[model samples]
Target: MTGSVTVAGLGPGDAALVTPEVTQALSRATDVLGYVPYVARITPRDGLRLHPSDNREELARATHALEIAAAGGHAVIVSSGDPGVFAMASALFEALETWPGDRHPEIAILPGITAMLAAAARAGAPLGHDFCAINLSDNLKPFALVENRLRMAARGDFAMAFYNPRSKSRPHQFARVLDILREECGGDRLILFARAVTTPDEAIAVTTLAEATPEMADMRTVVLVGNSATRRVGRWVYTPRSAESAAG
Candidate 1:
């Protein structure tokens, strides 16, 4: 009897953001696996098989979690932010493809609040229209891919949010993003940086793509580059009129 699999979203930087479904899933999981920082955010369950590691160990950890579930243990693959949005959900499926076991466990991915959505809501309405999320880390992907995505967003005039924009090893990648936007977008494009949204020390600031310097951003910052239609109303930034407002 193989135990079920639950890919849970732990939410953005707060316990309060944990959904009831995710909380229920965690309560039933026998093995809870995730990157160490995310795993630590949840309370220690009575009998959870806790496995934590650095970000570099993602594949190995996902494989181990599946193995545990195939062996009839209730297992959970946890991620910060929504599990499916550039998070752990894809890794679980990819790892399962190479799995040799016959045991098919019930795998469920419960959704939760993502950092982009939460950050946008906290700072105002930066993502009030069509948007894009681009991950800047070149560790797993090529730098070309990152730039290509940026180019796409710039061309589409999509409101853009960036993830994993910078780290110790890749400090200047986000600066390149700004350059791409400034070249494709105008010099006055509204840009907002929301750091640690919904957390105790959260910071939100509005700037233009031409004005958002590297010093104003870090890995903790979720960056928002506005679309052609996006605009700032005092502290709040918004775009794409709602259907109700449009009809009126």
Candidate 2:
């Protein structure tokens, strides 16, 4: 078999949102690898093998998938949300950078609906204008960098979506994030907390920066902060598409 490695996204917790392209890749996979929860989403079959690992083993998982593919097996690596966005695709390429093997197996990255986009949709076009996505985890980068990016994005009046906003381990950082937003964007700016988007337990709340609390968000939440011009009409929150809307 001509071996291939396909990195696929499972999308935010909804089966319906998983792309057909990713589904096709999984159906043909001889070996599959991913974080435990993501791997669990895949159905087990007679000829398929699932390699589930802890969150910290991304590089190892990617290398193993490559090895399997190079040996003429169809390997599929899964990730929640798009693999290219803070997921397994980057790790797979990082392994390829130092790959000692002469033969490079075919590699492909398949996209899926990410949590930020799902959350944005739930809140109705909050990202209609210019926006930026930021990962607030600080696992691979410094917290100062996160702070700087938050400040710059807010100061530039761009709509923003945040991933990995708050967790039990670092519960207090999100408080600082809220404070920074208040300083840069003022108290009346719109902020949204969308949790478990597209899943049965999904909850979405839109509030002002002044009323927003850190406890409202968790690891499962995707937070959205609207630009200065973002507002609510009836019940929907959205940013006006015109540049003049910001100045008006």
Candidate 3:
């Protein structure tokens, strides 16, 4: 039997949030490959093999999963959130571009609940209107590109969700990001700092751009900035579904 490769999302560190489809895929996988923390989430089974690697080794992990699948071993590559959202699915396809074979192994991409959606839900519909998700890490892309996108998103009056907002290595970048947001969206715009949503250590903070500090975010946090119309009602923060004209 020809082997197949599946890229699955584990869903934001919560087993309860993992979809039935991903659970079924894991049950049938002979070999599982992913970042060390993500691989650790899978339970050991008699016939299963788990290969865990460092966070920066995405391309290598994807290639190894493809090689295993091509050799008639059922392989699954796991990612933290939805595989297509800045995760392994794109890396796998990049590896497939250089894969040498008469016929490639069958591949599948299974989606999971992404971090932004979970964070938004926890914050009471802050993303109720149109929004854009941005990955703030400049590891693969240029900082200039990220700045340009942020400016355009704010200019279009779109709410924004940011992933990988801060890390020890890139500490000052998020500060600069906050500066840009403050310039574009002004100091009164509301921003939410959500860390480890749906987990035991989860914390959510809602504050304005002026009140939001760079220290408020870390690599584990997902940052959300509300548009012009976003506001708070009682204990909840949300953007209305309808658009209001400037004349009104």
The C-alpha lDDT values of all candidates are 0.82, 0.92, 0.93
Q: Per-residue CA lDDT of candidate 2, range 71-149, in tens?
A: 8999999999999988899999999998899888999999989888998888899999989999999888999999999
lDDT ranking from best to worst?
3, 2, 1
Q: What is the lDDT of residue 153 in candidate 3?
A: 93
Query: How big is the positional error of residue 32 in model 1, measured in Å on the Cα after superposition?
Result: 1.2
Backbone collision count in every prediction? 0, 0, 0
* Candidate no. 1 TM-score: 0.93
lDDT of 2: 0.92
Q: Tens-digit lDDT track for model 3 on 19-109?
A: 9999999999999999998999999999999999999898889889888988899999999989999899999999999888778899999
Give residue 186's error in model 2 in angstroms.
Answer: 0.5
Worst 10 residues of 3 by lDDT: 239-248
Quick one: best lDDT, which candidate? 3
TM-score for model 2?
A: 0.96
**Top TM-score model:** 3
TM-score winner between 1 and 3, please give it: 3
Better of 2 and 3 by TM-score: 3
